[model samples]
Target: MEQTANKQTRLSQRVRSIQPSGIRRFFDLASKMDNVISLGVGEPDFVTPWNVREASISSLERGMTAYTANAGLLELRVAISDYMNNRFQVDYNPDNEVLVTVGASEAIDLGMRSIINPGDEVIIVEPTFVSYAPLVSMAGGVPVAVGTTAASHFEVLPEDIEAAITDKTKAIMICYPNNPTGATISRAKLEQIATIVKTHDLIVFSDEIYAELSYEKDHVCFSSLPAMKEQTIVINGFSKAFAMTGWRLGFVLAPPDLLDAMLKIHQYSLMCAPTMAQYGALEAMRNGMEDIEKMTLSYQQRRNFFVKTAKEIGLPCHKPDGAFYAFPSIAHTGWTSEEFAEKLLIEERVAVVPGSVFGKGGEGHIRCSYATSLVNLEEALKRIGRFLEAHDIRGN
Candidate 1:
């Protein structure tokens, strides 16, 4: 027998310091419980439509499995270009300005990686997606979180934006039809942010994956601002709007030089998005507006029901103007968000994500995704009522 010396290989210091996403803990716990009605996830419950799936299947049959160029299939990029122009009035040169990514998730990661240098600060608005901070950290950037209140309907004020800026600040990270809050930036608001960004020469990383899902108004693209366009990277995908999450297809639009550099990074780091999904996205661009209309209408109906039911159940939810999430104040419950979430899962068999999981300002709130069936929504609200009443929580 050979004797071995003790040794260990440790992770990189950056990797070691980063913690796993807070969004997954509730999900892991909820999975083991029986008869649980969970609204804890951000993903839609819908399957990719038959046409989109058929397009993927057709690609498989044709054996287009090998890798294509790093920037993605030309036809898909062209489609993306046209799609943006038609919908958002932002024009991108598909050949030199767009790079397909693994998902909006990876698009976000790559977008930050391509921009930030060590110690540079990335401004993030809360409660935002959980991925932004870690990815910023990974790119050697410091995260500066600006917390918006429920009283403002979670809007990030321009004064607050101005206050959060430092000389180290490199970019503004924004997501709308925001994840946990369902809050969106209006045209005036987007312009205001763009003006500040232009004045400071700061880059804007705009994640508008939920653009098509807005119920109150049409989605605004920040890149549509001429002064902001040159310094902005618009990252969007076919996920939320078209119910194509697992398809893992997304694209980014940047200035010519940034697109060129990002394509090289994408080529080595991610290679290419799944080819079949690109074909499906091509179909989505061609004929999926109706599908978006259909899905958005359904989501809006569910959103209405949830806002009503949740407010009635002591959660004090606002009627979301966009995305299918209700960010409700649970202040009536003496328990903190995590505690409320834990007891609800164990006792009432209903699961909602603790808003605090998103970041600092989220403590007394909870995010309940309405991306589920109407029947399930009704049942979950009633169970939440039972849980609140049993715990002696008062309501409006």
Candidate 2:
């Protein structure tokens, strides 16, 4: 027993230090329950467009199962390059500047591992995705969180980012059309952040996976800003907007040198993204704009109804500008986020992610995804309303 314990203790400290994802914990709990209405996972409810699906089926029928180059298929890379340039005004050289990965999740991990050295610090904007900080820590980097509040509509201000930087700070990771909070930064605000990056001489990992879903304004590609392309590593994928989450396809656009380093790590860990999924993504780039428009419109309508309903039920929600989540203040319920989520799950059969799980400044809130059907949203809202009434928290 002593020897077995010693062997287990020899595992990497880095792997042992991080906790399992808070979002996944609640998602699992919700999955085990009967008649649970889950707003915990941030996945779109729509299926992949039939055209894109058919492309993957055609690829399989044609026996295109063999791996392409270690980087990715040339045709897929070219398609992604053209898509980015045409849609976002960002140009990437398909031959050297783009790398397709297993998913945007892999791209994020690869970017950190390629850039970070032991003990380096990465500044993470909080009330964002759960994966950012853990991926940084796994890369032997320290994660310094800069919190964004609902009061500021969860925008990561330039000053806050500046304050978080230290001599050891190597990179800043940003996610816009943000998760959980659903906040987005304006073009002018992003330009201010770009200036800060230039002044600090730091690299940026911009996760624009939700870029196409922005309702009110076009998502300004961070790399498109003046002199920013070389310093910014843009990560995006087909999971959200194209409703291709199960396809597990994502890509990174970066300078050749950075792309080379990321490719080295990716080639070893993930030889290439799934061949069929790559084919699907290729089709999406070539012919899925109409599908994206339709999905975005549906999400916009859902966002409007969900936010309005939450406010009516006495939850002060910060209306999300992008993404399909509604971050509502649950402080008035006089319960911790976890407690509130637990009680709601048990009593009302509704599952929302506890805000505290998304790091600092996430306390006193709960993240409710509006990606499900309007019928589901209505039922969940009714259940939530009853829960609040039981607690004597009437709508204002």
Candidate 3:
């Protein structure tokens, strides 16, 4: 056989060097295996509420499936504005500050693209969402990852944020009521961040996708701060709270100039979020919040159970104040996070995401998602206990 030339095999170095998302690789593998109780995915397991589905059906029946304006359906944008005000104590004009995109995922990408110039630095606090770094790279920006440890309960400290800054630091991408760790900053801490961003005149992309799932106090919006509003872009969506992950509906709220640039990108890249999704999202805003509250209560119940059980199994646990994830340190288990996850899935049929998949800071931890049923959570914990015991790490 003739050898292929380097010329034929050439690809973009960025594409070649970048690793396939660790989270996605395991999820794809686990999904193909049977009897796996997967906690690997961070999405809600709940059904998209009935009313929202009905609205989508109604829209299709009424021929409302045609494309709307690039900014999104006016009624839905107005609904989003009203909902954010009633829920988060923030006031956005909706006209200039909001552009709907496909789920919070796309909004995050859009925000990154709008502000990033080639070689600009985007500081990201790690063990964060898998998308942030890759997306930043794709947008011709450099991603600076700041490590947060298990001892600090995975909250990004002001000092750490300060240390990661450089002349090229154009923005910071932050997700609160965080994904894998479920860590959150209190209002006082956010104020500290406000101070940093205000001092540096830095732009902030705050991903509050899990905002509604916060357990103790209601979620706070970065834009709620009068000073922060001008430099902040808020990315939120219906996926977590309304159980609408499949709907592909999310929106970006920003200052006018930023929103305009994002809309140009959106129009060119995706044109608009689905017309049917807009109608369904409008329904969710209008009447589906009680359903959201029910889901939050369920997740909180599961969180409480997982925390208690994880401790019983000798894991050092952090109580999550919001979101459905519980990140427990398994350093005592004599295994890396992925090793721990792999053993549990192979030996006992329970599935979870390794914390290291999130970033370097997550080396000794694993993310336990309580978005599954109570029965599953209990069974998974039992399997985890057995896995730990075999390693002589439980109940020492």
lDDT per residue as tens, model 1, 1-396: 123222212456777678887778988998998999999878888887888888878988999888877888899899999998988898899889999999988888888888889999989989988888999999899999988888888988877888999999999898898988999888888888888998889999999989899998888898988677798999899989889988888889999987887877888887898888888888888888898899999999999899887777667877777988889988776778998888889999888988887888888989999999999999999998888788778578
lDDT of 3 at 34: 88
Which residue segments of model 1 deviate by more than 4 Å? 1-9
Predicted structure with the largest TM-score when compared to the true one = 2
Error of 3 at 74 (Å): 0.2
If scored against the real structure, what TM-score would every candidate get?
Answer: 0.97, 0.98, 0.96
Compared with the true structure, all predictions reach lDDT values of 0.87, 0.92, 0.87
Comparing candidate 1 with candidate 2, which one achieves the higher TM-score? 2
How should the candidates be ordered by lDDT, best one leading? 2, 3, 1
Residue pairs that clash (backbone atoms under 3 angstroms), model 1: none
Cα RMSD for predicted model 2? 1.1
Better of 2 and 3 by TM-score: 2
lDDT of 3 at 220: 85
Mind sharing the TM-score for model 1? Answer: 0.97
Candidate 3 per-residue C-alpha lDDT over 144-254 given as tens digits, one digit per residue, 9 for 90 to 100: 999887678778898889888999999988889998899987888788888999999999989999999999876789889769989899999988899999888899899
Best by lDDT: 2
**Which regions of candidate 2 deviate over 4 angstroms?**
1-4
